[model samples]
Target: MRWLLLIWLILWGTGVEVRAQAMSRPKNLILMIADGCGPASITMARDYARAVLGRKELALDAIQVGAVRTGSVSSRVTDSAASATAYACGVKTYNGAIAVDTAGRPLATLLEAAKARGMATGLVVTSRITHATPAAFVAHVPRRAMESEIAVQMLDQRVDVLLGGGWAYFLPAAEGGRRADHRNLLREAEKAGYQVVRTAADFRNGVRRPVLGLFGPDHLPYEIDRNPQAVPSLAEMTRTAIALLKEDPEGFFLMVEGSRIDHAGHANDAAAHVLEVLAYDEAVAVALDFARRDGQTLVVSVADHEAGGLSLGRNVDGRGIYDWRPEVLARVQASHERLIPALRQSDRPDSLLRAWLGLDSLRAEEQALVRQATVKPDRWPVVLTELIGRRAVVGWTTNGHTAVDVNLYAFGPGAERLVGSFENDELGRLLAELMGFDLSSLTTTLRQQQPVGESR
Candidate 1:
């Protein structure tokens, strides 16, 4: 036995055996997207988790193999739709494209290919199920805003598990929904044998295969504003999706998105951003735990782009020194979305000022800014964001996405494919290869196909 072990070690050490071992395919793939979570955003979240939440380390920090360039075909800074398309379809499309090439032609996505090869496919997101990120995986459209059409395509694709918000898109106009066609997609989904779940209870109780869960009318509430009784956490949705998809012996492909991290970043709300990242990290923990136990799964976590150009440390006292106050961030009780509505509803801004700011005492100037924000409906978010950033020691360059390379973290079988720097589109090709799919054939077939309204 000792001699056999020695021979195995020798073989492993040799370049020949190492190459073969590294080429091994993963039976299952879990692609987790922390939308707009860049390096600085991650640093702020990590520090806050350690200082305030008492966490020793984040699951994401453990498996960070390297960074990946996130440029789209149309722009250096990519949007959620285009980046997701690149990750899902092995091609770089325009910013608004969803599972389509730059010419508006449909592209066979990773989930479609996985399903074609007898693998169970699932999508779990904190955003609308038909939103850009998740839509890119299974739906082909010229624009990401065609979510109602995306919902139809989702059903057409026969995805095994569909979970997240966007209930409005599924319901018809007659049912007080945003759909223009008056077609009740929820009924159509039910007729097609999906166990549709709407609330937290339904999600927990409806544990069967072919489950469809839409928790909110739009994107689910931010983690800081979420009610546990009404909505499920990202971690909960991840576990449920894994449970359903893993039952397939042929293996599975699942995409989970921490969708609202981008929104909080856009708002430049540092407290809310950290909370969303922590929520995303919890989902990461779930995936890592499952991958470790399954051993045949490849778990990859990445970001689409960097939003807000977030900087962790702010200049303090005009002394050229930077500082971050985790305690100030810890005092935040609600998200900007929640606080804004409350401010609008309440006539007494002065009484609710300090509590809403989450600070024990606010400077006179800060108090004056908050008072002005409450009265000035147009400048409310900007002023509040500034107040939050000043107190928490966070700084933002812009309230939009930035052209920055995002970090990539991977573990388990085929994790080697994710290491080192590469274009965002290359990730899709690597993932296709990892799943043992012929990318050349898939691309050729998809390109040959024309758009819905285009004449051949």
Candidate 2:
């Protein structure tokens, strides 16, 4: 989907932009974006990370970092389309245009330049590969919804690696696909010399040729909701993409996105949000593992925007008010999730609702109404909000992208350049320069200490 700029936000806060200062040449560039991940999500991630590691260690906190204003060229409140385009094209276009400039002209992306420079390129996302964030790297579409046509364009880019869902658009309608052209993307990619694969086993055991991996028909399943049969986790894709792309001697530029963070936010599912963030964190670990081992890779993790400004903390109660006990809180969500689907799906929701909630005195419609009121978001249930609506201190805001500054965290060479405020597009230029390309997108300097690997 395209990033939409819905609101014109006034610039707030006190940080000036930084020019590209490449402190060291990185042999490989792994760029990861947690889609719709805003400041609240970052805080939630740190809290979850601290809880999981049983210590205060977030890869984010280690970096020389700063905030970047994530608004699109046209509006302050950015969608993924314009945001991704800004960074990928280095020139912002109106929302929904991909790889095209503000004037609607196609321009080369950092990936294209890298390919021309004999560098390998890979694009990975939990969202469809045709989704705006990934498409901005190589596609120039008048609109983002043209997924079937976008699939055809993938063959033209000659990218070394492509991994994500959206197989429905690759196959024919007769074969349960969506391609009006009726082209078999898998075979076409292979005929073009890519080693196409459809499963984890295929990906893991397959030979290293340029690869096309279509794991699912749309977005990959969320970590907390997926079965191995449907879609692999983001970490699996990351590890596999790194392994395949790094084999090239010219080095590689890899874009890995954790898409479901945005989905969780849209659904206002706090638990799912935290779980997906942790999943992305695992992928982060995968990239960092490769970077540290290679000793020449630069890893930067940033979010395009904030979704569902989240707040998490215990609420007070007693003589006054307080959160239900932890054990009781868990029970509330569990029972509700088990009960809501039947209520929404049953031929007689009111009757079933009466049986489920055990309030026989209530009328059928009232029972149905209560069930509906309990799950304001969607087909699932969450206890976090019952706490919030009751004045408990746990909830999220907006349930949509906000015009908030996103954190830029980096590690490895040139990361020192990340120490202050900067625009998201400047990151595009910095990556271009570090991989030894001239973006002409922005001018940044090397660290005061100088970039390493000059002699190599």
Q: Please give the CA lDDT of all the candidate structures.
A: 0.87, 0.69
Error of 1 at 146 (Å): 0.8
Top lDDT hit: 1
Give the TM-score (vs. native) of candidate 1. Answer: 0.93
Off by over 4 Å in 2: 1-23, 52-55, 313-343, 346-369, 373-392, 440-456
* lDDT (tens digit, per residue) of candidate 2 on 45-87: 6765665446575555666377777877777887787778777
Question: Model 2, residue 222: what's the lDDT?
Answer: 66
Expressed as tens digits, the lDDT of each residue in 223-263 for candidate 1 is 98899999999999999999999989999999999999999
lDDT of 1 at 329: 80
Residue runs of model 1 more than 4 Å from their true location after superposition: 1-23, 316-320, 447-456
The clash count for each model shown is 0, 17
TM-score of each: 0.93, 0.79
Q: Give the per-residue Cα lDDT of candidate 2 at 329.
A: 21
